[model samples]
Structure formats: structure tokens, C-alpha cells
Target: MIRLLIADDSALMRKLLEGIFTAEGDFDIRTARNGNEALELVRAFDPQVVTLDVQMPGMDGLTCLSRIMIEAPRPVVMISSLTAEGAEATLEAIELGAVDFIAKPGGAVSLEIDRLRPLLVEKVRAASGARIRRTLRLTERVRHQIRGAGLASRPRPSRVSPSPVAKIGKVGMKPGSATLPGLVLIGTSTGGPAALDIVLPQLPADFPWPILVAQHLPASFTGPFAKRLNRECDLDVVEVNRPMPLKPGTIYIGKGDADVMVAPRAAGVIAMPVPAKGSYLWHPSVERMVASALDHLEASHLVGVMMTGMGNDGAEAMKRLRLTGGRTIAEAESSAIVWGMPGELVKNGGAEAVRPLEDIAETIIEMVNSCAAN
Candidate 1:
């Protein structure tokens, strides 16, 4: 059974969340009215997952999250409002070792309760089994430094070589075999729903190439996420199935309880779902997806884009993508809800282009066109 601790100052909010979790069955629920009370409950209950609100009467959620990472090292999901300040604080919580967060809907307890039901349940389940390690002091120090310095104006590397243009399938003119997207991989997290909504719908129907997405999401949510994307986008998007063939304009989303990788098959590409064990310390690992894509696809035709999210999950992967002669783009900070993931990529020189959410679709289309032309 999964055990959870709910920490919030609002009496009604806590009651509603407790009621929801209790109704779900198999969950042992505990409640805390403030950060101090939450700490006490943590010591007493030793819960598997914790849902902490950012604003509390006494110690704020960030402080409690920091202490929890130090003392217990359990999975924590922050509940924050959608205001700019709330978003900034939530990002701080993530940096302080909170695994993920859910944005409170409409700044109201009732509306948030309704909109967040699915996310809350999914996060609680995912957090229950996560092995959270004690956060190192150095990590926190580095995060503080990065935040203080402001990452927006960091210098970017000059493009050494232009991306090769490649065309695939019936979408466009057949390029001389030289130019083609060798591998197509995407990474997204928090704010992915809205960002993908904007980007995917703009992609033309029958666009050629196999696209793999590694969105940081719990297993229960991937199926719905893929379906939602499929409905809005012209291309086919589906949760990955083992041994499935990789085809043009089809997207395979990594789903729950497994890490999706691509392996070369005599017939074509095969979806390899590995046990979660160490395959992904976190769900929908961007590193695993990017590494697998690079190994399976030719270097010259690779393209990697890191979308909005908190933390640096995709940073290393983006670096690997760059080393292999692939084109890489990151969602610019201004357009991102959290900016932690994409900002890290930009700071580390992993992204070849930093673009707003509105421009991502056009940028990708241009990249594909460039590949074809090459």
C-alpha cells in the first residue's frame, strides 16, 4: 500500500485531498497543517510520498523540502499556484530535491482539486517506489549560483557547421541520399501539455521520420498524453509497444513502469522496453532516449530538442546529441513555465538554438527542410 503525507495550511484543501486519496483505497493518508507539522508527520509516519504546498503559515514548502531531502530523502511533489512567484518558488523546490510538482488550477482549492486529481494520483504512485537519495550540498550550492547569476544572457557557441538538409518519405523531394534526419528524438516535462499543444498541431500531416518522445510523466498518464497529442497533431502518436516497428511520422511515447529504447532490428527498428530498475532513476528518462537514438541512428541526421521542465534531466543528453553532429534546440526561458531544464542546456552550451515556444514548430520545420536541402 502507498502511504502519503499531505501538507498544506488550508484546512479545506487538506480535507479534500485526504478524502480523494482515502477514496482511492490502498493509500494510508496523514495530514499536516504547516511545515513544522509536516516534519513531525514525516518522522512519525515515514510516508512513501509527500504532497507539500508552497505557501504555509510558518516555514515555507521550500524550507521543508530542503529538510526532507536532508533527513528522509523521500519523493516530494510540490503543489504550487500558477502565479509567477509561485512558479519561481516551485522551481526552487525542484532544485532543492523535490521530484516534481502540480500547478494549482485557477488559484482556487476546489478547481485545483478537480483539475489535479489525475496528476495527484499518478504522482503519488510514481513517488511511492522512487528511491530518493540525500541531496548533496554541492548540488544546492551550484543551483543557487546558477539562479543568482541569471541564465538568460549566457553566451552561446557559434555554429561550426551548418545542419545538413534531409528529406524523408512522401513529405518532400527526395534528397540525394546525403541529407536526412538520421535520428529524431524529443524531450519534454512540466508544461509539455501546453507546449506540445502549440508545436505538434503545426506539424504538417504526413511529415516523414520516426519521432521518439521522452516526456517526464508517470506511467498512468502517458497513454492519455499520447492520445491527446495524437488528437491535436497531424502525425500519429501512441504509447510505445515492445517490438513495435519505427515508421515515418509516427511518435512512440515511453510509458509507465518501463524505459523505452530503440534497438537495431534486421527488419527495421524495434522498441525495447527495459525494466525500470536502473534503466531510469526517473520516469521517461531523456538521457536513455537520446543515447539510444544516437546509437541507432546515423550521426549526421540526428536532431534533438529539449522542451520546458524543471531540473537538468535532459542536459547531459543534449550534450551527447551535440557531440554526435546533431542539431539541438532548447525552449527559451521566456517561453518556458519553469525554465530549469532548458536553461541548464543553454548554460552548458548543449543547445544549438534557443527559441520561444511559438517558434519551435517553425524551427523544427526549418531544420527538416535544411536536412532535405543538404
Candidate 2:
């Protein structure tokens, strides 16, 4: 049986979660009324995974999460409301080592909560097996130090500090490589937000190729995520709202509720939103985006990269891209948070190169530079 902990201040919520998990029959459940209680239960129960609410009296989710990481680190899934502030906090939790998050179906107590059973269970299961560490990076430590020191008239480092880049040796094109790639396409899910935070910031401001991203996220979350990326990264990250010519150095994030596709116009390619169809399992489906690229851009001028995610959404499409002379890269297993999507591509022979997360940005830069040279 899977060991699980449900931490929330609301008695109603705690009971509801208990009922849901109990009904599932495979989970061994434990409950906590607040963060303090949750911490105690974490030590005693030693759950494989935990579901932490965003807010609670006496100890909020963020504070509790920090404590847990310091004391007893394990997979944690945040329970958040579907609001802007909630989205921001949820993202922060993910950065703080939470595996995933679930937006409370309706605020405190809604019957709709039951509707999220599948997602909640899935996230919990995934979190239970995640790889995490209790120690913080130097930059991360400095941020907490500043906060605790009350910003005392001292030089403070940025809060969202980048992780150290792993030693990535040389990566090169295969023999008889197809035409040089001009467009860059990236597809990711699961722990992608945190992964993107690492890779995107490493690219230069003058990155030559136009880039597109298809990350699995809700409509309410992507805007804030894009804004966060724009603030932290050198590249200009913008949400795709209408059809406009793709520009170099700009990263277009597909809208969360719709499909983003590239259309060839007389002047250039324009990205437009298409209504979601049941055929696509993920909103802003990666496969849909790649299909559009295949239709409009030359195969040789396209590069597809599949990063950390939970499904094989882009595997077949990446394979097709490779077959058509486009380059493809998959995140190496060791560097992936889940290795689901990238693993799919690598398993299916779609990737020409499998690279570590720290190496992916550099690899892309090299691919673009080499393609330009060719």
C-alpha cells in the first residue's frame, strides 16, 4: 500500500481527502490539521508522499515545505486554489522541491474535489518516487539568509538562483546530418516549470532562432509562468495571443487552453490559436505544435527538443522530424525529473542527441551556430 499524508487546516477538507483516498483502497492515509502537526506526522508516519495545502493557520504550506525539506525530505504535492496568487505560490513550491500541484476544484469545500481524484492520485504516485535533496544551492541559501536577516543593509543575491551546470562535454551532429535547423521547438510537462527555469535562463539575449514552447499547464498558470520567465531569462518570453510573424530571440509560449500552430504567410510564419480538440490529450499539445511546424517549416530547418515530462506526447512527432532531416534532442535520463517524455523519444529512436538538462541550452546554442555556419 502507498503511504500518504494529507495536510490542511480545514477539518472538512481533511475529511474529504481522507474519504477520497480511503475509497481508492490502495493508500494508507494520515492527516494533519496544520503545518506544525504535519511536520510531526511526517516524522512519525513517514509517508511516501504528502499533499500540502497552500494556506493554513499557524503554519502555511511554504513554511511547512521548507521545514520538511530541512528535516525529512520527501515527495510533496501542493494543493492550491485556482487563483493568480495561488498559481504564484504553487510555482514557488515546485521550485522548493514539491513534485507537483493540484488546484482545489472549488475553494475550501466543494463536491467537485472528488472530480480530481485521478489527477491527485497520479501526482501522488509520481511524487513518491521522485529524486530530491534537502540541501539548498549556494544562491538559494543566500536568498533565505537575506530574508531571515530582514534584508539587513547587505548585498543580497537573487532569490531564484540558477543551479550549477553539470560538466557537459562536446556534443556534435551525426554523420550525414540533414539540413541545418532554423526553428527550435521544445515540449515538456510534469516538472517542466522548474526545468525550464534552469535551461531558459542560460540562453543568450541574442539567440538567433525563433523558439516555441508547448508545456503542459492550465490556462490560469501559463501567463504568470511566462511573465516569470521573461523577468528571469535573457530571452523575450511572450504568450501567443494572435497570429504574428515569428521573430528571432523571442520565445512564444503556446496558450494553455488552446492549440498554437504556425501558418505560412507570404511574408513569414504566423502563430495562431486553434480551439482545443478532444483528439489532443494535452492542451497546447506538443504534437499539434510540431505538426504545424512540419506543415509550414522545412524539416531541415527545424529542431525539436523533448524535455522532462510524464507522457509520450511528442515522441512520434520527434521521430518524424528526425526522419525528415530535422534535428532532435532528448533530455538525458539522469538529468530529467521524470524522464517520461524525453525517455519516450530516446526509446523510440527519435532523438539524435540525448543531453543533460544543464547541457541542453549549450547544445541548442551549438546546433544553431553550426546550422548557421552550414
Candidate 3:
């Protein structure tokens, strides 16, 4: 049985969660009334996965998560509300090493919880299997940020090997031409936000191609998530709410709950959020998004990046991209929290280069520059 802990100040909330997992018959569960109690149980009970509430009585969820990351590193899933404030706090918790989160049931009553039961259970189970080693890497990032420009951070991802210029973007594009720029298709989930933090921040404001991101999130979280990335990165980041003109130096985040796609327009190529495809298991699906891009744009002009996430959402289509003469990069196993998405890409022989998380930005830069020179 999977060892699990549920931590929340509300007795009702705690009980409701316990019941949900107990019904599954695969969990050896424990409960905590508050953060202090939760901390004690973490050391004493030693659960494999933890569920923390955002608004607990004693120590708030964020603070509690901070302590847990330092005291006992384990997979954690935050129980968050649906509001903007809840999204912000949950994002912080993820940065602090939480593997995933679920929006709490709408009402104080248990009846509403049935709707979230399946997803909540899946997230908790997934968290149980996630690698806690990502937490150590994140802690290193946090410490570097705390130094306040004192010493440079740990080595940035090493310089990518020199690749054929033709293998970069479109094979024969000359510099300074009027031809519209190519697109970068990026798809990730689960630990995507933190993984994006490491890659996107490394790119400069003048990045040569537009990047489209499909990050798995609920509808309420994507807007704020895009805004947060905008503040931290040099390139402008915006949610793909409408059919927006594709421009270099801008990163388009696919709206949550829908699939973001690329299609030809009267003016030019545009990035737009389309209704989620019924066939894809994950919304904002990486597979569906990459397929959409392939249908409208030249395969050689596209660069597909598969990063930290669960399942094999992007592996098949990215493999197709590589076979069709496009480039692809998979995040290395050492840096992935789950090693599912990118691992599949590497296993399938799609990834032209497998890079550690820190080196992805430099790799992209090199690929884009090499393409430009050709």
C-alpha cells in the first residue's frame, strides 16, 4: 500500500480526503490536524506522499511546505482553492518542492468532493511516485537566489555541442530575409512551471523565434501563471486567449482547459486556444498542439521541446517531428522530476540531444543562432 498523509486544519476536509483515498484500497494513510502535527507525523510516520491545505490554522500551507522541504523531503500535493490567491500560493508551494496540487471542493460539504475525487486521487498517486531529488535541485536554486548577487549560481547548463546549421531551424534560410520566423513548440506538465523557470529565464529579450507553451493547468491558473512568467523572463509572455499574431520574442502560454494550436490566418500564423480535443487524455495536450503546428507549418521550421511532465503526451508526435527532419530536445533524466514525458522521447529516439534542465535554454539559443546563420 502507498503511504500517504493528509494535513489540513479542517476536520471535515481531512476526513473527506481520508475517505476518498481509503475507498481506493491501496493506501496506508495517516492524518494531521495542522501543520505542526503534520511536521511531527512527517518525521514519525514517514509517509510517501503528503497533502497540505493552503489555509491551515497554525502554520499556513506555504510555511509548512517550506519546513517540510527542509526537514523531510517527500512528494507533496497542495490542496488549494480556485481563487487567484490560491493559484499564487499553490505556485509558490510548487517552487518550494510540492509535486502537484488540486483545487479543493467548492463547498464545505462532502457531496461536492465526488467530482474531484478521481483527479485528486490520481494527483496524489502521481506525487507518491515523483522523485524528491528535484527538491534538492530546487533548494540549490533558492539558495543561489538568496545570495543577492554575491556569487554566481551553480554552473549554467553546459554549452551544447556544435550542431549542423541546417539541422537548426529551416534548412536554408538566409539572415535578414522577409520570410516569417519559425516557431518553437514546447509542451510540459506536472513540474512544468518550475522547469520553465530554469529554461525561460535564461533566454534573452531578443530571442529569435516565438515560443508556444502547452503547460497542463486548470482554467483558473493559466492566466496568472503566464503573468508570473512574464515578470521573471526577459521575453514577453502572454496567454493565448485569442488568435494572436505570432511574433518573435514573445512566449505564448496555451490557455488551460483548452488546447493551444497554430493555424494559418488571413494575415499570418496565429496562436489560439482551441476547445480541448476529446481524444487526448490531458488538456492543453502536447500531442494535439504539436499536431496542429505540423499541419499548418513546415516541420523543419519547428523545434519541439519536451520537458518535465507525467505520461507520454509529447513523445509520439515529437518523434514524428524528428523523422520529418525537425529538431527535438528532451530534458535529461537526471533533472526531470518524473522522467515520463522526456524519458519517452529519449527512449523512442526522437530527441536529437538530451539535455539537463539547466542547459535547455543554451541549447535552444544555439539551435536558433545556427539556423539564423544558415
Instruction: Output the number of the lDDT-best candidate.
Output: 3
lDDT of each: 0.71, 0.79, 0.82
Per-residue lDDT tens digits for candidate 3, residues 1-374, read 99999999888888889999999999999999888989999999999999999898878888788788876788998999889899999987877788888888786458888888988887888789887665454574575466557865433322334332232333322233224467888989888887887788777766768899999998889999999888778789999998998888899999999999887766667889899889998979999889887777667777899998888997999999889867899999888887889999999999998998878887877777655665
Better candidate by lDDT, 1 or 2: 2
Give the alpha carbon lDDT tens digit for every residue of 175-241 in model 1: 3222223456778776555466556666666566777777775555567667766766667988884
Cα deviation of 112 in candidate 2 (Å)? 1.6
List residue ranges in candidate 3 displaced over 4 A: 133-179
Estimated TM-score for each candidate: 0.57, 0.88, 0.88
- Residue clash pairs of candidate 2: 182-301
| Residue 302 shift from truth in candidate 3, angstroms | 0.7
TM-score: model 3 vs. ground truth: 0.88
Please estimate how well model 1 matches the true structure, expressed as its whole-model Cα lDDT. Answer: 0.71
Worst 10 residues of 2 by lDDT: 164-173
Q: How many residue pairs of model 1 clash at the backbone? A: 11
Among all windows of 10 consecutive residues in model 1, the one with the lowest summed lDDT is 154-163
* lDDT at residue 106 of model 2 (Cα atoms): 78
